[model samples]
Target: MQLGKAVRLERIMNRNNGRTIIVPLDHGVTVGPIYGLVDLRETVNQVAEGGANAMLMHKGIPRCSHRRHGRDIGLIIHLSASTSLSPHPNAKTLVGSVTDAIKLGADAVSVHINLGDETESRMLADLGAICSEANEWGMPVLAMMYARGPKIENEYDPDVVAHCARVGVELGADIVKVNYTGDPKSFVRVVEGCCVPVVIAGGPKLENELDLVRMVHDSVQAGGAGLSVGRNIFQHPNPVKIVAALHKVVHEDWDIDAAMELL
Candidate 1:
């Protein structure tokens, strides 16, 4: 790996713990500007101040939301989008290029791929293209791979999630984001199958903060790298506290009881 890219990846994943707490703030493209994101600059600052390893956002966010002063966090530009209201919501399309992301001072670029979607081929092609382009610039690529489609009986099936993670590695992703398969035993398959680092998605916003904290604990126990969470952390009334709680789980390997105390 190029020293520049290696150094940037270190910003996202802690060198000591080999894990990360990436708060994704790019939902506006798919779900409109929801709570916790109306004021992008403030939201970014809140998570960074809480010791989040990185923030994944769309191209425009860096220009509009990056704080002039505060804790500096790694920035990853998400290149794919598909609205929930779309007829084929799982069919993600690329809206930004790696070169565009690099110009925006991105440390890395990410792409979303729905493995069983009707447009699965298109998304895979986009992943390959982005990886190729990102490699030339020595930028890391993070693939958010999911099994979502009419044919998929269970997106969180352990076998299916393993496939999702493996695809990210097969396609040259430096890191892979996937859904947790409920427990450590099942989720371990995903972590083992992929050679690259595997992080769990926060999934839907849970009913309580403890549920989110427990999920992070479970994923870490399963040997997963960490989390790429969004609403559960950012949309919470106490965003900074929530991220601090999760940081304990990911970096310190705290059990639920210890992590929950941070909340």
Candidate 2:
């Protein structure tokens, strides 16, 4: 890698103790102002102060997020989306380009891919093309891989989830964001199979805080570099405390019980 690219990667790795704690505020494009993220800046500030290393958002949010926050959280630009109200919500379309992301001063750019969906082929082509472009720009790509098709009833199936993660790396993603397989042993397979660093998605918001901490702990134990959580942190009664707890799990390698105590 070139000096600039290597520096950027180092910055990302350094932020979360070689692991990552990225709080995604890109929800507005998909599900406008979902309960907790109504005020994006305030929520981002709280998490950033609580030790979050990075914040992922669509173009709009980053346009306003402060550059000199408590600890210079890295910014990731999400380039794909399809709102829930859209006619084909699952068919993600490109909304921003890698060049646009760089122009926005993004440290990295992310794309969402729904494997096995009707529009899978189109999205895959886009992903490959975007990866190529990102390579030339020396920009990192974070692929959010999820299985969603008629055949995929349970995304948690070990084999299916593993395949989804592998495909993301194969498509040239620098970092693959995937769902946790409920157990460290199974999730370890997914992480081992991917060529690039693996990170776990927060998925939907959970009702309990401990459940979220346990999931992060398990994923990290399974070799995941870190987490890309959204609703789980933002929707919590105390997002700052929640992030601090998660940081302990992802960065400090604390167990669920220990991490929960921080909350």
Candidate 3:
């Protein structure tokens, strides 16, 4: 671990708690500016004000969302993307580079890898290439690893999730993000499999806010470093409320019951 990378990762994850709440705004590239993201700056401001550790976005967005007034938030540039319209949307292809992220003043860079996808080999190869580039610059890399594709029966299976997370660590990711295995006990295997920090992803919008908070709480209990949840936090009518609640759960050691009060 280089000093440069360590220092940069501190900006993304709280050094004391070793946890982070990263809101991904890169959804626009994949899903077309759905819901809350229509105003990326405002959404970023709201979450930043609520104490989000970082915000992840594609290259063009950092410049637009970087503002002068709100609390400073760390930025992670997403390097891969594929639109919903694509025939194989799960096959994420690199749309930017580590150099591009650094030029955009990103504290970290992330790439998506769908393990069981038809193009897994390409995505994995690209991940290795980008990681090498990131190493040269001493930039931290977060791998968005998922068990998605034809063969996967239940992506949430703990074994499958753990394998996805391990792939990130094996490939040199500083941090790994994968889906939670419904409960804390099951997700523990995921954290144990990867020596690096592991964060859980918010798959889709949940029906209730309590469910979101509970899921985050359980993941934390299972030793998750934090969350890279997007739509669940951003799409809520009160984005700040949700991010604030999540901040408490991830950083302040608040219990599920206590955390739910924020919402």
Residue-level error in angstroms, candidate 2, position 105 = 0.9
- The residue-by-residue lDDT of candidate 3 on 1-263, one tens digit each, is 89999999999999997899999988998889789988778999899988999999999987678787869999999999999999999999999998898888889999999999999999999999998999999999999999889999999999999999998999889999999999999899899989999999998899998898888888998899999999998898888888988898889889988987777
List runs of model 3 lying over 4 Å from the truth.
none
**Cα deviation of 171 in candidate 2 (Å)?**
1.3
Show model 1 residue runs off by greater than 4 Å. none
Model 2 spans > 4 angstroms off: 15-17
- Please list the C-alpha lDDT of all candidates, in the order they appear: 0.91, 0.85, 0.92
Candidate 1 accuracy as lDDT? 0.91
lDDT (10s digit) by residue, model 1, range 1-263: 88888988998899897899999998998999999889999999899988899999999878889778999999999999989899888899899998898788888999999999989999999999899888888899999999998799999999999999999999999999999899999998889899888999998889998888888899899899999999998889888899988888888878899877767
Over the stretch 1-263, how does candidate 2's per-residue lDDT look in tens digits? 66666666665665345688888888888888788777767887888877887888888776566645556778888999999998788899999999888888888889999998999999999999999999888888899999987778898888888898888889888888988899999998998888788888888878798788888888888888989998888888888898898887888888887886778
Clashing pairs in 1: none
- Lowest lDDT block of 10, candidate 1: 253-262
> Order of candidates by TM-score, top first?
3, 1, 2
- Winner of 1 and 3 under lDDT: 3
